[model samples]
Target chain A: MENTQPATAGRQDPTALPIGILAIAGMTVFAAVFLMAESEAAVGGLLAFAAVAVLGAGKLGLLERVRAAFRDHELTMHTAIVIGALAIAWVFREDHFALLMLTMAMLYLTACLGLNVQLGYTGILNFAGSSFLGVGCYTAAVLTQHTAIPPLVILPLGGLMATIVGSVLILPVLRTRGHYAAVVTIAFAVLFKTFLEVNDSLGGPQGLAVGEMTLFGWGFNSNIEIGDFYASFYMNYFLLALVITILAFALTRRIERSWVGLNMDAVRIDELAASCFGINLARWKITAFMLGNFMIGTAGALLGMILGFIAPTNFTFADSLILLSIVLLGGMGSVWGIALASAIIVMLPEKLQLIQEYRFLLFAALVILVLRFRPNGLLPRADRIYFPGWRPR
Target chain B: MSEAILDCKGVTRRFGGLVALDTLDLQMPRGAILGLIGPNGSGKTTFFNVLTGIYGFSDGAAAFDGRDITAYSSQEVYRAGIARTFQRSRMCLPLSVFDNIMVGNHKRLDHGLWANVFARKKLRKAFEESYEEAHELVKIFDPPLAERMFEPVAGFPMIDRRRIEICRALISHPKLLLLDEPSAGMTHEETRQLMDDILEVRDRIKDLSIIIIEHEMGVIERITDRCIVLNFGRKIAEGTYQDVANDREVQEAYLGAE
Candidate 1:
């Protein structure tokens, strides 16, 4: 009676939809909204229109029909879709729009992964993620202005500083249970922001400027050339971000499959049981908190480097809410799902600039709809990777 | 007396005005099976909690293998070679069967974050070894369950869940294993099979003492070398199962006022 339902739920099917067509369709709609709209408000409205159309298509199972069309070529379709999106983004010189949207997409992707490790995998709901982001930004800002070190040295230092602060702050907070932990972290966020605002040495409320980064006199602020075409500074920054994003993704994916991840999963499921099994609860909880903050701090440093400016206002409760929304809307514990969700949430509202005024309302409606219908997000995590070809049977 | 692997001296636990485990005292030698039977609210679970450091005692001390463990935390107590199972199943339902058992091997597993990220091959090798061991143990306990090692525990039957809980405890390689009604929801045959498996486990693991709480006299009579009967947070009788069953105080405690 027990071994019936494949033992695990929420696994995403490889042949779910013709993803290449979906990506092309999604990006084409995005590009079209950017091109034809006279005003930002019109773009926002058009983007909203496109989102609704997709939702309607999903409900009607039109996506399913398209999925069935490419069932035989799933792998090829997926690869083609990815290459197509990259090619389009490369060709389009929508400098301000493409660069900012793409950079922030990767930024949010990093932050969401951090939150996923804490809240999703370890079941520690930390509302103080933005505080760690601020810590990282400030660390970089302070170090770059005061020290002779390159951005490479300063960046990881920022993460280390955030880890130190986050580890100390979470100790007292982790003593509490689920909702209490949330409240404690929320208080910590408020305290961090307030400290930054009141302290005159840290530039008071006007904020600080982070110097342009260089690696051994190779200025990141300057544009680089490849073959014939000269890449923009933002594009260079985007490439740098892409490298970091891949590293972060690979590291987190590895951790997810490791024994430490399994231990955290145990603690998340049942704290008492995990304890009885000889798992140190505080140790694992702290590992999740500190490591999560470290990644988040790196994302913050990236944000600071790209903007070349820092402010207390940049890392706020609203930013924390958005970060949390990325985790929730993405689906907990699904890394790639979070990356996709981050891109959609960050880029969609900006591209559809028509509804900028009603952006929150639109986002709220979107989140509610996602939770209502696809509670597990667009891509749920797969259970195990089966390579049946190599099996003895 | 000093050979006792687990020793409790005047252990007391109070929740407000109510004393849950009142000045309880017990001792067990290595490789011995001690059955603790009491009516509901007689502090059987409370004593277990105090011993495992889940609940702090109001007074008195508990020692495990000559070390004072009264103030130790649950994890500390476990690392000191103690493990327990809940009266109700506490399986991590979403995790795979291999993972659930592997969790019990966490203490022995390579747990350093850097090791997990950088030294993955070594960690994976260690994990594979543990997984194989867990698989072997599962095969010995229940062969059918070993086949579903990769499946999630959510769909396992009640009996299998119970078996996995015991297996989880055993994987820790504890000196003292605390079983809280392992046969709570099982049929008569299932209970007998569980008892046999418990004895088999005791036979396999060297010097592996067990403290089991059971309501069924037959289980206590058949499995326990000695029994302690509790009533109203106080032990009223202690001896062999027949001796405790024949005692007037133990009889009155179970049957109630007449």
Candidate 2:
């Protein structure tokens, strides 16, 4: 007799929806408190409390239960998360600095997600993430300055330009593996910075001033006033960043769940086996590299417009390391983990001004600790499950 | 044979003047199991590697399904309807059982990024079909394993992992399947069970020809319709398993010359 029972049989919990909703709400509240905290002492206290809470939840096995709940109500949980993000924006509408930091985090989230495709999914070692981002930034800067192109078209154009440049780098990357591949990207990072510094048409070391992003007739830099309600102009960029981040997240998730992700993972895990099984290693590697570069480049273009400036110093090798650390600290191959890690990496330094100068050192120390203790990452990716309700018995 | 599914002529592979495989000629009829047996360092595995395009043939010609696949890359060789397992049991261990099997299903999958992301109904249908196919293959090998399709291959025992590897090769629906030392690290009882599974798979799938590199004489005697023996990269004997077992050169190669 054929076993025809659905794999998810008897695993459904009725409380999943409420638990998922509560989890999202709790996370939103925590973000609000973390963002609004004015004193260093308050920020430190909140961090310590969060650490204790997370530890306690793990001890009580609440983490697994909550994850299961979220898995059961995936669509509902996604909707809740989007609503929570919008709520955070509304809460900080009048606070320009807070809104700016939040927007920056969203943009960084997009870029980190892009990096995750290379480092996490396909195991392509890329130490020059910021170099790719710089390509996008400069592309946006030059196009906005010289041509009459709209910012919307320029955004993806920046990504396309980055993809073209990354295609050339991939030749050397494909010829090598492991540490050698990593060195190739590192060399590219240095070469890109030096190129920007030497080239006078690209504003040299001083960089170029980017114009404001105007959609239709509305300028992204203009403050908004609705009768009695008022908000900073950064709100416009914040919303745009949110949409882009959501799209990137969805795209990354789709890739992870499909045959494309399976082929990439096969190539990542064992190239010889993948090839013997009919997987085109170079083709998939190039696909991942170009796709990741496109996302990173797109994020960079929007970031250039938001900041209204592009400089070689803004895209130094150290900046690339920061992005790499975020991918590492988040745990390679875990998209949600990358998002959480990026939030902490982006916001904590800004909140604690005392550690701003030594932020790189702090990130280095954090990554080392995570590698030694929780090697898989803060929230390691779970096993890939193709069917929604499927579970191991 | 007039209906040979795999034909290799003058296959030669050398590394820095050391011949790993000498000028070899091999042919297998359709739906026949050909056992490749040799002592350690006798170039049995090397023959498999060369055939699968892992190590390029120094000089040779191999035709599979009547198409010249001598110069094909590994990926192209697979697309040419040739699939293989590794001597050391190569698998993406972190991947699930279903995923390991689906890796071989690339020939059937729609690989377009746009289709994967936006074609929801089509992707879902493909996923369902793949899941059913993988589940059935695993069930054919081991019924209990089919239930744990989502479990990672890392946790499975060696015998089960070997079964999964064979399943991975079979999932591709190739006309020719290559099995490299499927009994490398298994007990006698496990080896017996695996051979039974292999025979069962051959019976279940029609027109499926297998080339297995095995060190176990009992397995070769039972499952193979024909046997080829190698000694120091040279073809020492060829015939039925019993005929090769009685050959003087085969005995001298396995034991020592008096």
Candidate 3:
């Protein structure tokens, strides 16, 4: 054991270990400070610490190595950041803004991953993504309010309901191509919103109150404390969101490397070629639409349950655009990129509330800039080989 | 003569006022290379599209291996042992060569969503086998290409893309392979090499029939066992390559002789 430890330690860069630990410590401290501080000052302190770290690392000549590691293990770094932020929040009991934004980011990530399956992998234009999210939210809300079903049961059921709606829409939606299909989705979103507003049984324009969700008799609406770390309702929701997010991420990554993902890609690149290869075009299209909506619906249900309310305004065409922008800005089909994009979309406005009114304009400009420079996204998907000996030596 | 594998009877396709394929009847015996020659608008591609079920035929029927497939969808036709290459190569450029080829074998894959997620051990085994199969097919088809199986299609030359398309079609183990202008953009030497490869592939794969659409008369004459000529969306002549070339109607269709 002693000999093996020395040999393994020799293989890993000695500096990498300490630097990683230091970086984690620094990030944790900075996050704790940011969570406890006022919004405007928190952003400043966070940026200052980040700048200092970058500059210090550069001065120490460790920046290049750090950058290389970050580049190679970008997902690991992002995951670490998320875990650190949540851990800080949980320990400190900072449930007001940090936990809220973190929960929002997770929900957004789930929704964007759903969109990524359609627009990124399947090449389907779905402007009705928000409508699916709304479907999920409303399903959960209506069920919790009217029925005696548990939240756990209603969550998957919400996804099923959204899938049904998405599948039914696919017939007309798939008939159109490219921009035309996008138009169809946009119209569908509008139709869905109007329908929600008009239906009195669905609470019409006023919306409905969602009952507190319980899982195995443990109410998520209430707070529980661990030995050292206390959990608020937001923290409970945050932990639940985190669990769901990780599962969704794992599932998505698996699908991306599987035949199912390959077929979706084939369908996206060339429908004619995909069909010629014996890929069921309609089935795949329907699958992409329905599965994507399923994820979105799940997120929607979770969001509604956590918020304890639902309204037609929550699922708007504007919200759909924002979700799509998250996918695009994150580098279409890139999981980590989408997560980063969602984080920015969810947290940036709150951090820079001084320019809250101009947040959309800033986001638009940032998107335009990113498109101009990195049109493929912040992290365009690289060629992943399925078989051995396919990589360049 | 071998058994007729692909039979099209009065298969007609109309695009509103214009007929793309007019009462087209074609039959291909197993282990035969039949060349389809035509003018620009003579519907050589249209016939391929119709048989492959890309475009719905307005009339008549198409059968593969004695089974009626006129109403079959494109993917259904493929599952029924028919695969085709496009005139303009349709490659998934962003995808790895291995994935592009593996996608051709998708019909045989275990693609249950829940199964893929939950059944890791079985799925991994299936994936490894599929990957190995793709590699083996590429190695047998083009030994040199076996090394570059992971490279994206975007970096590949047009000829390489064409070869990869052929390899993809072959991986599916289709009984009838359709080559729609496979030599459209190739030089004479390249076309000759492609012809040799096609002939070699035919020799290797037993009972495989090919219907090649070509504008190059040399390709038609050298590669095809028999030639069918089309003009104005109708068959003008059908015979041996030499016979079709010498036919007055075929000559007029190409040269516009008075």
Per-residue lDDT of model 2, residues A189-298, tens digit only: 99999999999999999999998888998888999898998999999999998999999998998899899999989999999999998898888899999999999999
> Which candidate wins on lDDT?
2
Off by over 4 Å in 3: A1-86, A90-92, A198-201, A226-231, A385-393
- TM-score, candidate number 3: 0.87
As a TM-score, model 2 comes out at: 0.97
Tell me the lDDT of model 2 at A72.
Answer: 71
Q: Which sections of candidate 2 miss by over 4 Å?
A: A1-10, A387-393
Residue A43 lDDT in candidate 1: 66
Model 1 agreement with the true structure over A356-382: per-residue lDDT tens digits: 778778767877887898887766654
Sliding window of 10 residues with minimal summed lDDT for model 2 chain B = B116-125
Q: What tens digits encode model 3's per-residue C-alpha lDDT throughout A131-192?
A: 99899889999899889998888888888888988876787877888888889889989999
For candidate 3 chain B, the 10 contiguous residues with the lowest summed lDDT are B133-142
If both were scored by lDDT, which would come out higher, candidate 1 or candidate 3? 3
Pairs of residues at least 3 apart in sequence or in different chains that clash in candidate 3: none
Give the DockQ-based CAPRI class for model 2.
Answer: medium
